[model samples]
Target: MRMRITRRGGLVGLAAVAALLVGASPASAAPGDASAYAAKIQVTLLGQPAVTAGPFAEAKADGPTANSLATVHLPGILDTGVLNASASRDDQTGAVQSKASTADVRLTVLGALGAEGAGTRQGVGNNTVGAQLIEAECHATQQGVAGSTKLVGVDLGSLGSVDATPAANTTIQVSALGVDVARIVFNEQIHNADGSLTVNAVHVTLLGGVLGSIGSGDVILSSATCGPAGLPIPMASGAGLWLGLGLLGIAAAPAAVVINRRRRPASALAAEAD
Candidate 1:
């Protein structure tokens, strides 16, 4: 048995599909900044800022550009060389990617000088981190997101020990006099409530009052954030709008033609047939 679909019914179905294309786009729905930072350091005394290094190597999708910085030092506290950050976005596809990197990092602390005479050193030869978000338009999770971090010659030193390749969000802390003194987190990743993603290659913080208003600092390295945004929405002007209009017209064409032909007189149809 053969089943025939009426022209009106097919047209209605096509119209519905066009409506979906114009009204909804799941992959590129979220909105947020795609950004990255290479490194920074801040020290506070009793919660007041004292020394600062940089939030320098930074990138953002506002301009969809990359940036870098070279050789930063704060004697006895921080030293680093060669930092880079970059971000890119496809406006038509609504895809974004971000990255950050750093080399020759060393953070030192003297218990006597600031740790109240406790010696500690945090070190790393080089590191890189990256994140990407693509629209889930065509495939299910494939090419949708990519994230990773790499580190070489890491010396946790007194900051706390860890495997060369630490797991995500690996943490270490130092305490004294039954109070927390310092903390470090490695390879951290977070998912925002707004459906965005953030990655931090390293984070360090030192609380004040280790030896009466002595040590206080906060630092971050190789950080990136990106929107889980997806494919472009079609409701706006240009190609998307034209595409929608074209689909609607095609769908309505058969139905309109069938209705008009049915209303014409049988003699007119016979004359055409003759």
Candidate 2:
């Protein structure tokens, strides 16, 4: 028996991912001296189950540690399903201290896919899917003593979906710097998959202030939470259906196997070396 499969949404998905990554602010050190503060990030998906293939396969991610800056990288393949991310920060200084955090991440769902078939495809043909979850956020804050007001700033960028369903959200943090600054912190969480959730945070504080400048120290904390095993939710199709339809044309090729298999192939295909 012979079946044919063709990847349809490659160009479109690549374009979206590229635009998402390139169209962003260039990274630079905070204006004036960097603030000394701390941050904590946490994220969770309400209705997602565990999966062996989707993003969030590894047990726990390499998280940030005390007094260290943290960075988390998502594997393209394992990144999928519903997503929720948030960040919070608290900072302290000799004259000022305050705290700030982004509580809710509205929406960021992208590139999900669904598949239909009895089992793995044969030698000449294979089943494939393209999935990814991505985001970039930055935050800062400064606070003075009690009775003194608190100033916090935050920026959040996340894009995700089940397939090519395309759910996106972007938020920018804006707060003025300079003052008898006290505290600072930042937190963020990205929904990975059913069982896997990636969370990260960065916290810091100032050793002291200079005559004309400020000095700061910070700690980084990151974590990945994997829930107990359970049923896998049906992944989204995104633009995978387009590809599946194209492949269906071949899978349902004229009178090859009497009738084409009813089962469907993954909506998207990510090129992977066998």
Among these predicted structures, which one has the highest TM-score?
1
What TM-score fits each model?
0.63, 0.17
lDDT of each: 0.60, 0.25
For model 2, residues 22-136, the per-residue Cα lDDT tens digits are 3332232112111111222222212333212212111111221112222223321122233323222221211211122222111111111111211121221112222122222
Q: Which stretches of candidate 2 lie over 4 Å from their true place?
A: 1-181, 186-202, 207-214, 222-274
Best by lDDT: 1
The digit string of per-residue lDDT tens for model 1 on 74-134 reads 6555667787888777766677778887777665532312332233333232221111110
What value of lDDT does candidate 1 attain over all alpha carbons?
0.60
